[model samples]
Target chain A: MSKESIILLLFIMVLFIIGGCQTQELNESGVVAGLGIDLEEEELQVSMQMARPALPGQSSGSEPAFEVVSAKGRSLSEGLRKITLLFPRNPLVAQANLLVIGEELAKTDLALIADSILRNPSIRKNAVVVVAREVSPKDVLNTQVAMESLSATAIPRMLRNQERQMGIYQEVSLEEFLNKLARPGVDPTAPAVTLIDSINGKAIRLEGTAVFKGREMAGYLDSRESRGLRFLNPGRIQGGLINIPAPFEGPGRVGIEIIRSQTKVEAANTDGQIVMRITYIGEGNYYEQTGEADILRLENIPVLESICAEQIKSDMQACIKQAQKLKSDIFGWGNIVYSQHPAVWAELGPDWEEIFPGVKTEIKVEFELRRTYVTDQSLHYQ
Target chain B: MLGSCYDLHEINDAAIAQNFSLDLLENGQVAFLAQTTQPVPRSETGETQPSQNISVMGTGRTAAEAARGMFLHFSRLFLWIHANTLFIGENLARQDLTLISDFLMRNRNLRFQTCVYLVCGVSIQDIHKAMNERGFAITSARGITQQIETQAEELGYYTPLANIELLERMLTPGIEPALPQLTVIKEGDKDRIVLQGMGVIKNNRLIGKLNPEQSQGYYYLQSKKKQGGLISIAWSDSPNAMAVMHCTQFTSNTRPFIQEGKLNMKIDIKCELQYLETIGDDNIYVPANQQRLEYLAEEKIKQQVRSCIIQAQQLNSDILGWGLTTARYQPGWWEDMAAQWDQVFPVVGSQVEVECILCSDGLSRESFRFN
Candidate 1:
C-alpha cells in the first residue's frame, strides 16, 4: 500500500478503537449503591440498590430514579448469580455505602457473608455494616428517607450523624468488625437499624447496638443503656440528659443536661479477689424541671450533686447489669483484666465465662452543676 | 478522559458505587452489597430531576467471584473506585478477618484510609437501609464517621481507626489494636446509631472492650499530644464541691529504664486547662483555690495514666505501644526484653508525673455572689 493509504488506514483504526472505548463506558452497568442480605428458609436472600441518575433540571419520565433488585439462592455467591437474572444491566458494587443484614442472618452466621471480600478487586472495604431491627434485609434496601435520594448513603449518613452528634454509634466498617471478631478479649458489636415511617417519607434509623457473643447475636443495648455506657467509655460526648425526682419532695422531675463528662474504670486485683472501680465526674446544669429546687444556695448544691450522682451511678450500673446478664463482655472487662493483671488472665483466660459474672464492680459518680440555665427554681414553682 | 483511550473503560458503560457491605449468610456464602449512583440524561429544558441511587447485592463463596457475578448478565461494568465504607457481619469478623482483609487489600479501589467496621447485633443490609431514602444516598466518606471525628477532637479520646492502621496493628507484635464499635438505638420516634465503645482485640478473637473511662486513659497514654477535652476535678476546700477543667494543650514524654534489672517506665506530662464551671460559690481564681485545683487535676491525671498502664498489663495487650516505645528509645533493653516483653510488660512498673496549669478563669473570678 502507498504511504498516504497506510496513514489513512492508521487514522481509521484509531477512530475505531476510540469508538470501542466509548461503548465500554458505563452505558449498560447498573450502579449498585447498597446491598442487603437475609436468611430465608436456609437460602441467601440478596438485595441491591440500583441508581437511576436524573438530569440537572430535566424531566425524566415516570420511571423511578432507583430500583431495588433481590434474588435468593442456596449460597450468597449463588444469590449474586441469581440477581443477574433480575437485572438487565451489569451490577456495579464498588461504591456500596451501606450493608444491611436481616436479624435472622445476624443470628445464624454473620461470618459467611464476609468470605473472600478482601480478594474482590472491585469492592470498597470501607462500607459500614448494620443489623436489621425487625425488617427484612431486602425491604430495608427498598426504603428511603426524604432528604436523600438513596437510602444506602442516607442510612450511613444518618448513622454517622448519630455517632457524632450523640456519640451513640460510630462507623463500623468491615475491617473493624473483623478485628473485633478475631480478637479474644473483646466481643464485637454493631449498630442496630430499624425502618421508620415518618410524615416526610420512608426512613431508616440506627436504633441501638447488637451485642455479639463470639459469632452469634447475644443481646442488644437500649438507648439509655447505650448512653450509660457512653458516659463510662472514654470519648468526647456532646451532651446527654438525665431526669431525676426533685431534690426536695415534689410532684415533678428535674432534667439535667450533662454538657461535659468523663469516666474512669480501674481494675484492682487483691489477693484472689478482683474488683473494678468505676468513677464518673461530670459537669452540667439543670436544664428543665416541673418542680422547684434551689440550686443557687450553697447548701442546696450538695443536694443537687447527690441526686445527679445517684442517677449517673444507676445508668452505669444498668449497663453493667445487662452486660453481665448477657454474659457478653461488651464493657471489655475481660480486656481490663487481661491488661491489668496478666497472671490473673493466665489463670482465668480459659475460664473467663464463670469468673466474669461474679466479678466485683463498684460505681461512683460526681457532678458539678454549673448554671441552672437561668433560675435555680423551676418555672412551674415560681 | 471522557471516552478517550482505546484500552480504558467508558464512563457511560459503567456505574460508580458509593457504598459496599459484606455479610456472612447461614449457608456459608459471602453476601456482597454495593450502592451506586446512576446518572440520567438531561432534557432540552432541565427540570424535575428524580432519584438516581441504587443498591445491588450478590453472594459468593469468595469475594472476587461474587463481584464477577454482579458483572454477569449485565450490559455495563461495575466501577468501585468511589465506594466508601465497608462492613463485615459479626459472625464473619470472628471467623476470619485476615481473609477479608487480604481480599480488600488486594482491591486497587480500596483506599488505605477507608473506614471498616464489624456488624455485631444487626445485619449489614439493615445498616445500608437505615438512612438511604428518596433516592438520596450517603457514601461512606461522608457518613457518620465525620461526626465521630469531630467529637473525637473535642473529647480527645476513642479516635477512629482506619483500615490500614487496623491491619498494621493486627499484625504488629508488642501492641494490640482497638476499633470503634457502633450500635443502633431506637429513640422515641426513630432509631439512632451510637458509639458503643472501643473493641479491644488480642489473640485475634473477640474478647472484651475498653469502657469510656478506660478508653480515655488508653487514648491519653497513647496520645503524643493532647489538644482539648474536659476533666472533672474535686474542687478546693469543700468535700462536696467539684470543679470542671477544660483542658487545651497536653505534652507528654515517657522514659523507659531497667533499674536494678527490673523494667520501669516514667512519664512526665504538662497540661493546660481553663476553668469551665464551679459547683460551689467560691472564688476559684484565688491563690488557695488555684493551688487546690492544680493539685486535684494533677492527682487525677497521674492516677488515670497509671490506671491505663495497669489495664494494658491486665489484658496482656499493650495497646499503648509500650513495646514500640521501648524498642525506639531503649533499643538495647528492648532487645533483651523482646522475647520476654509480653511477660515483662505486665510486671513493668509505670510512674506518671503530671503538672497542670490553670490557663484561664473563664469570664469571671468569683461565683455568682453579687454581694
Candidate 2:
C-alpha cells in the first residue's frame, strides 16, 4: 500500500478498536453515592444509594435526589448485580463515599466484607467505613440529611467534623481500617452512626467509636472514652475543650481550651517486667470562669493549671481502665512494645491478648495555662 | 484549532440552574429545590421582556436522586455551572452536611465558589412560596448574596462562606465551619428574607448559633483585610450616656509563639475611627476625655473578642481557625499536638491588644448642649 493509504488504514483500525470496547453513556449507568452491607438469614444483603440526575429539559426541583435499591445474594458482587433487577440503570460504585456495615454483620465478621471491597477495582480506597449502631446498614443509608443530599456523603463529613470539633471519634477510611486490621500489633476502629429522634424527625448522628479485634468488632467506646482513645493516637484530635471544677473555693466550673498536646508512649523493661509509661504534655488557655473567684489572675493561674492537669490525667486513667475491662488494646500499646522491645514481643506475640489486659500502665499528664485570653481580670459586680 | 465539535452541547437545549435549596422531608427524604431562569419570547412590538424564573422541586432518599427526580416533571438537562447559591434548611442543617458537601465538591459542573447559607426557623419551601407570593423583582437568593457583600464589611454581623471555604474549614484538622444564616420574617402582608447572624457547624451538624454581636467578634478575629463597622461604648458612670464610633480603617495581626514551653497567641489590632455621635456631654476637644474615649473603645473591642472566644469555647467549636494559626506558625509544636489540637484549642491562651485612633469627629468637635 502507499504511505498515505497505510496511515488511513491505521486511523480506521483505531476507530474499530475504540468501537469494540464496552462503553456506557451517562443515562445508562447509575451514579452511586454510598453502599450498605448487611447479613440476613445467611444471605448478603447490599443496598445502593443511586444518584438520579435531572432529565434534560426537565424543570428543576421536581424529582427525588436519589433512590435506594437493595438485593440479597450469597456474595457482595452477586447482591450488587441483583440491584439491576429493580433499577433500570447499571450500578456504578466507584464514586461511593461511605461503606456502612450493619451492627450484626460487624459483630460477626468484617473480614469477608473487607475482602470484597478491597477486591473491587471500582470502589475507592478512601471511602469512609462506619458501623451502624442499633440499626441496619440499609437504615443508615436511608437516613436523609438536610445539609447534604446523600447520607453517604453526610456520614463521612460527620466523621471528619467529629474528629476535628469533638475529638471523640476519628473517621476510618477503607484502606486505613483494613491496614490496622491486618497489622500485627494494632487493631482497627470505625465510627459508629445511629439514628436519633429530633424535633423535625429522625436524624443520623455519629455516637461512638467501634473497637475491633482481628476482623470482628469487640465493643464500642463512649464519647468520653473515645476522647481518651483519641488522646493516645498521634494527630487524631486537633481541637477540644476540657471542663474542670473551679480551683478556688466557689461553686462553679472553669473551661479550659486545649491549645497543643504531646503524647509519649515508652515501653520500659525492668527486671523481667514490661511497663508502659505514657507522658502527656498539654497547654491550654483559661477559656472561661463560671465562678465568682478571679481565677484569671496570674496569682491563681498555677492552681487552675494543676486542676486542669488532674482532670486530663483522670480522663486518661478512666480510658485505660475501660480498655482493660474490654480487653482490647485500641491504643496500640502492643505496637509500641513491638517497636521498642522487639525481643519481648517475640515471646508474647502469641499470648498478647491475655497479657494486654494485665499489662501495667503509668500515665503522667502535665498541663500548663498559657494565657488568660483578652482579659487578666474577671468582671466584678457589686 | 484541531478540536472537533462531534459532541457539541447546545446552550438552548440545557436548563441553567441558578440556585438550590435542600431540606429533609418528614418521610426521611431529601427535598431538593432549584431555581432556573429562562428567556421569554419577544412581543409583537419587538420589545424583549425579562427572563422568567422557574422553581422546581424534587424528592428522594438523597440529594443527587432528588435532583435526578426533577427530570420526571420537566424534560431538560439541568446545568449546574451557572448555579451560584445554596440554601440549607434548619432541619437539614441540624442533621448533617456531609452528603451535600460531597455532592457539591465531587460534581464537575458545580463551582466551589458558590455561596452557602443556613436557613433559620423556616423551610426552604416556605421561602420560595413567600417570594413567589410577594412577586419579588429580584431573586431572593441573589438579593441575599448582594446584601452580604454590601453589609458584611460595614456591619460585621456575619461573614460570607463559599462552598470551597466551608469544605476546607470542615475538613481541616483544627477548625470548624460557620455559614451565614437567613430567616424569613412576615412584615404586614409581605414576607422578607433577612440575614441573621451565623450558624456554627460542628461535627457536621448545627449545634448552636452566634448572634450578631458575637458574630462580629468572629469577624474581627478571622478577617485580615481592612474592616468597616460601628462600635458603641457606654459611659462608665452614667447608664444612659453612650458614644458611637465609626470605624474607618481596621487591621489585626495574630502571632502564635511558644513561651517557656507553652503555646501563646498575641493578637495586635490597629484601627482608625471617626466619632459619629455622643449622647452625653463628652467633649472630643478635651485631651483627657479623648484619651478616656480611646481607652473605652479598646476595652469594648476586647470585651467583644473575649465574648466571641468564650462562646466558641462554650459551644466547643473552633470557628476562629486558631488551630490553623498554631499549625502554620509553630510547626514543631503542631507536629506533636496536631492530633490533640481539638482538646487544646478551647483552652489555648491569647492576649489581644487594640490601638484605636480617633481620626475625626465628623463635622463637629463637640456635642450640642443647650445653655
Please provide, for model 2 over A1-382, each residue's C-alpha lDDT reduced to its tens digit, 9 standing for 90 to 100. 8999999999999999898667777678999999999888888899999877754333234244688889998888889889989988887789898888888888888866777877989888898898888898888788765324568876776565444333456778889888888787778888788876532246677777788887788888886787777677754235556667778776455666676688888988776577889888888765555423555677888888888878777777777777778777777878888999999999887888888888887888788888655445653311
Worst 10 residues of 1 chain A by lDDT: A373-382
- All candidates: TM-score of chain A: 0.82, 0.91
Clashes per candidate, residues 3 or more apart or on different chains:
155, 59
DockQ for each numbered candidate: 0.02, 0.02
Docking class of 2: incorrect
Per-residue lDDT tens digits of candidate 1, residues A23-141? 52486888888888888999889888988866555533444457899999877778877988978887888778778878998898877676745556555668888888888977777
lDDT at A62, model 2: 25
- What TM-score does candidate 1 get on C-alpha atoms? 0.47
Compose the digit string of candidate 2's lDDT tens values, residues B1-371. Answer: 43555335466545677788898788867788887665444565665554556566766555655665454333345678777888998888887665465455545567888899998998998776665454333555566677787776676667788887887787786778888898889999788888887999886789899988888877777655336778888877677788888877778778888887777778887878878888876454455688888888888887787787888888888787777788888878989998777687777888989888988887876687767
